[model samples]
Target: MSMLVFFFVPAVIFLTVVAPIWLILHYWTRSRQNKGLSDEERQTLEDALSVAERLEKRVATLETILDAEHPNWRTAREDDYRRGGS
Candidate 1:
């Protein structure tokens, strides 16, 4: 009871006043200081996006091939290799 009594006022003060001010200041500073992507970073990001797009196209092509080769390949979750016959 005494411990609770000692902590209650400080906790209330922190929750009501300190935490809100801290959060506001933190976010405000972050927003103010946002130096968006540098030239190198931007170029790297573009390259990465291009690579990702190419990979996606390749995957689609592979899937298309698999689909044509075996129409039921998508539905077949084969566990034939399992020791206890699944």
Candidate 2:
């Protein structure tokens, strides 16, 4: 009756406040424990990044020359506008 509801109300309120905090900490610890990458994996990532950096440098040099020659060449916004109306 009223006594039962009073006890149940506090229990529900306590659970509402505490459940999310408990679950968040639980998942955070689990993710840190589970998602560790090995040293070899990190080395592979560094190698891939180096290759990407070299390619980006080359593309940037080409873009600089293109920009100097034709400033408005192949702007994506202009291309999109042309395509949209046509």
Candidate 3:
């Protein structure tokens, strides 16, 4: 019926076109608004950094032992030509 077409045509257009555009724009803006690190993630990163600092000290101790055992042993920076130093 013409009345049915008149009622549903605009609704179908709104659903198919306007609604999708609105949804896409809304999601795009929301994603932009949420771009920064969350507080929990920042805290976790700080913890990881502290763990890394501890590990670095441990690695330095290991490196000292390694150097003592092998007098001619070279670090990655000392022997640029050698492979697999790191």
Please list the C-alpha lDDT of all candidates, in the order they appear: 0.89, 0.89, 0.90
Compared with the true structure, model 2 gives a TM-score of: 0.45
List ranges where model 2 is wrong by over 4 Å: 1-35, 84-86
Candidate 1 lDDT tens digits, 1-86: 99998999899999999999999999999988776887899999999999999999999999999999988776564544354444
Q: Local error of candidate 3 at 62, Å?
A: 2.8
TM-score per candidate: 0.52, 0.45, 0.67
| Better candidate number, 2 or 3, judged by lDDT | 3
**Judged by TM-score, which candidate is best?**
3
Shift in Å, residue 52, candidate 2: 1.7
Instruction: At residue 68, give the lDDT of candidate 2.
Output: 93
Better of 1 and 2 by TM-score: 1
What's the C-alpha lDDT at position 18 in model 1?
A: 100
| Consecutive 10-residue window with the lowest summed lDDT within model 3 | 76-85
Q: Top lDDT: which candidate number? A: 3
Candidate 3 lDDT over 2-58, as tens digits, reads 999999999999999999999999999999989999999999999999999999999
Whole-model lDDT, model 1: 0.89
Candidate 2 per-residue lDDT, tens place, 1-86, comes to: 99999899999987998888999999999999879778999999999999999999999999999889888876865797888843
